[model samples]
Target chain A: MARFKLTIEYDGRPYVGWQRQDNGPTVQAVLEDAFAEFAHGEEITVFGSGRTDAGVHAKGQVAHVDLARPMTSDALQAALNHFLKVRETGISILKIEEVDAEFNARFSAKGRHYLYRIINRRGPLSFDRGLAWHVIRPLDAEAMNEAGQRLIGTHDFTTFRHVECQAKSPVKTLDYLRIERHGEEIHMLAGARSFLHHQIRSMIGTLELVGCGKWTADDVTAALEARDRAALGLNAPPDGLYFLRVDY
Target chain B: MARFKLTIEYDGRPYVGWQRQDNGPTVQAVLEDAFAEFAHGEEITVFGSGRTDAGVHAKGQVAHVDLARPMTSDALQAALNHFLKVRETGISILKIEEVDAEFNARFSAKGRHYLYRIINRRGPLSFDRGLAWHVIRPLDAEAMNEAGQRLIGTHDFTTFRHVECQAKSPVKTLDYLRIERHGEEIHMLAGARSFLHHQIRSMIGTLELVGCGKWTADDVTAALEARDRAALGLNAPPDGLYFLRVDY
Candidate 1:
């Protein structure tokens, strides 16, 4: 079997997330359907690096597919893009490369990066309404940054994990965490070997409280030490989170 | 009567355009309805700085509303924001200030800024799929910038305007023209006292030709002097164009 690694981009607004669900359309199903057409009478399955919740966008998502047909990667990429374009699929294939038979897009990845955007202003940023979180009050950037800094390093992040997370363990090695402010917009960047379900969002939710002066850096540290899910703050809304990259 | 000036923002995807149309909902109609409701039995009208074509977004659009009530600028701003929030209108009133009785939003504008975003890559940008123009091939930024520099002056832009333009003269002063590249995206900024219909888009189309090496900077100058509408290249699509700001 020829294994093709695909770099994908998708607008998650119209999707029911990246997984196949009976409830509604999904990015995975859309790509699988496209692959089926490319295979012509052959069933096709696609493996994604991770699952993103509905309304969560991805600028650089990686996936892999194996097919019986032997075709050039460039031709396959062009054909898939053309097919997706006609359906107005909101999804596009950025690159296609033939990988070693053993290379798995998801399992071979070393780390992932995510960015959460917050529009902190008295007036709504209509241009990015659903694409970013809108907060009417001004945010304290220094406090938010200090609180986020506490999240760096490896630890058991059970407090920031979702109850339904399928990951085997809550322990994760977080490589980087930082908050940047550009005018009225605040961007939070997080990098790790992998993330537990809703972990980054939960961390952002706790940091938002710090920016609002409701919590301090010490509070975030305390939550991490507790290692109990109940110790974590509310999960921030999913509109602002984006899968930026996956490093192999 | 209190002459209230408003700065507005909108996504522009659902509306037919900024102006009210029998075909679809408009930003103007939405604002008028909200204003009329807030005024109780009093009639209200919102005047926009300029009409944005269908699917054209705005980050800083200026408007004026007339109300037969005594209200502070802060109160009106807060009230309208609250009212618009309830209907979940894609449009938002960013700022409101009491203006002179003689002031009109459209006629008193000193300058306008526009930005056209182009994603120069093989894949789509998930977050801004409908908000940007995508080009599969890499473009020459130096060539595009050279060609754009030729358009930064007063000239009869008849060749770069739509035949349906309402301006009495094709002559207008272009204050600035700049092209910047970020990652795989190309952003073009234009500033002028006023613009003819589709002026920025048409200019962008011509510049794109230069970027592709299909034409040269001197060719753009020749097209300008041609005066005939047919002398110019195609009009760029509206997806990437944004009404960035207005100087009052």
Candidate 2:
């Protein structure tokens, strides 16, 4: 069987995360159903780079599927888009490529990139309602950036780990964390080989406290050293998080 | 009575239009209901710059309302937002200013600015669904711009005006019509003191034919000279239209 790497973009609303579940609809189930149609009634499984919670959007989410039929990547992409559109789901197969069998979508990734969007405006969002986290309070993006620097490098991220996280270790090295302002929106970008459950959201929540002038860089360092979930300042909602890209 | 000028924004997906109608819900109705609560059970009427057809979003729509009770702009804004939110409408009052009694939302406007967004790509939109007009064929933006310039200045826009338009005269001065591309989106900006119904959409639709090499600048000039609605090429959908701003 030949594996095909697929790039996808989806609006995370009306989804119960990326994984298949009995609770409600999911991105995985929708993709699998579309693949099944392309596979001529045969069931197909789609493995994703990572699982994203409900209301978490993705711009360059990656996945892989092995199909028994021999077809060009372009042919497969056209067929997949046709079936997915028939389902009327917001998921779109952006592009696809044939890859070696050893290229597992989940384990063969070098790094993952995420971006969190925040709009620091009091006006209710019209076009950007579900696309951004609106914070009425003016955030100090400079302060947030300074605090983000403290979270870089190796550290025990227990304070930022979700209690329900299934990861085996709390210690992970964050390659980089950057915060910048773009027009009315503030963006928080993070990079790492892998992350614990909700790690990015948890870190972003703590940095927000610093941005609002309630916390300092040293305070963030202390929180990281605390190595306890209770020391976490907050857990940002899933509304603005985006799986930006998965590096090869 | 004090006349208050209010800057507003709304996602037009749910509303019938900006005007009040018995057929269904409207932005004016929602704002009036919120204002009625703030006016202490008294009825309130809102005057908008113009009516935006269904599915036409607005980022900086302006309106005016007269209230019997005197209140600070801040208080009025806060109260209006509170009531609107409680009603769960997607409308937001961006800013409010106390205006002169003669300041009419519909008549006092000197000019209007509109932005039409077109996504020129083969891929189906995920985040931008219902927010843009997706054109599968590649467009020649420069050619479209050249044709747009032919429609600038004073002209009898009968071919471009809607058949059911209520305006008395077909002669209208179009100050500017410019087409520019930004990333994957091509934006058409139309500026005028006023326009006949469906003028902008009609003009853009014809220009699209020019962009796709089906028409030329000379063709647009001939259509303008024909001064007949039958001469029009197409009337683009309202999904891509945005009421960007009303200039005073």
Candidate 3:
């Protein structure tokens, strides 16, 4: 069997999550159905880099699946796009690359990038209604950045992890975390080797408190050291989170 | 009664053009409903600067509404936004100005800026799926610019005007028409004193032909001089069009 790496993009609004579930439609199920149409005999199992929660979008989400067909990557991409046209599901297969059987998309990834967008304005924008976090109050960008800087680098990150997290350990390297302002919009670009369950959301929640001047940079550090789920602030809404890129 | 000018932004996907229609919802209908809630005494009539076709978005559309209550422009803006939140129409009143009694939004002296976004790529984008025109083939940007220059000067654009256009005179000063490329996206920014029915779409259709190498710059001029609706090319999809700004 030959391995095919697929670069995928999806609007996560309609998805329960990336993984296949009986509850509703998913990015995985759509691709699996499309793969079945192209893969003549064997059932194909597509593997994603990570599980993105419902309503979280992706621009460069990576995945891979093993197929029995001898088709080239280009041929497979064309066929999959044609099949996906049926639902207009807003999920796209950007590129397909033939890889060695040993290659795994998730395991081979060196890092991942995520972006959280916030629209700080009095009136919510229609175009950005669901695509961004609408925070009416003005945020202190410097304060938010200072607090986010505290979360960067290696840490246990237990304070920011979800209670139902499946990771064996909370220790993870946060290579970057920065918050910047453009017009009335605040964008948070964070990157790391990998993340614990709900780490990014939880961190953003705590940082949001700092942005709102409710918490300080030292307060953020204390929350990290406390290693308690309740120590973190409110979990920021999922509307703003986007899986920007998965690096190799 | 006081006239309040509104610089508005809306997602035009749900509306049946900007005007009120019996068949479907409209931007006018949505705003009128909001105005009715804010101003309980009188029925409100909104006069838009231009009637945007259905599915054509606007980041800077202008409209005027008169109300019996004597409210400041700022309060009017706030109240309109507050009342608009009920329906979740995805429309925002960006700015409001108290205009003189004689000022008419539709009849005011002004020019308009429209932007047509073209995603020149093989695969579809998740976020902007219905927000842009996806042209898979590689387009010649230089050739498109060369052709666009032919439509920049004042001329009779009847060839590019819609047959159903109601304008008395077909002659309108075309201030500027430029086609520029940014990364994988092609943008066409056009400005004119006034537009004929489906003028922007007709111009885009002809320019698309130029970009695809099917028509020459001279051919565009010939089409403009023909003064026949059949001389124009295809009407580009409304999704890619946006009323970017209105200059008065």
For lDDT, the strongest prediction is: 2
Query: DockQ for the candidate 2 complex?
Result: 0.42
Residue A169 of model 2 has an lDDT of 85
Candidate 2's C-alpha lDDT? 0.90
The residue-by-residue lDDT of candidate 2 on A81-173, one tens digit each, is 888982268898878999999999999999999999998887777667777788888899999998899999999899999888898888899
TM-score, model 3 to reference: 0.90
DockQ winner, 1 or 3? 3
Best candidate (score: DockQ) = 3
- Candidate 1: list runs displaced more than 4 Å: A85-88, A124-129, B21-24, B78-89, B124-126
lDDT of 1 by residue, B1-248 (tens): 78988988888777789998899989898888878778874668789999999888888899988787799988887788777772366787777888998899999999999999988987655557668887777899778988899998999999999999999999999999999888888999999989999999999989988888889999999999999899997788888988988998
- Candidate 3 residues A13-103, lDDT tens each? 8888898999998989988988887665447899999988888888789999887658888888888988887337888888899988888
DockQ of 1: 0.49
Question: What is the C-alpha lDDT profile of model 2 across B1-248, one tens digit per residue?
Answer: 89999999888878888889998889999999888888778998899999988788888899999888889998888888888982268898889999999999999999999999898876688877777888988899999999999999999999999889999999999999899988778999999999889999999999999989999899999999999999998899887898989999
Span of ten consecutive residues with least summed lDDT in model 3 chain B: B121-130
Better of 2 and 3 by DockQ: 3
- Quantify all predictions' global Cα lDDT against the true fold: 0.87, 0.90, 0.86
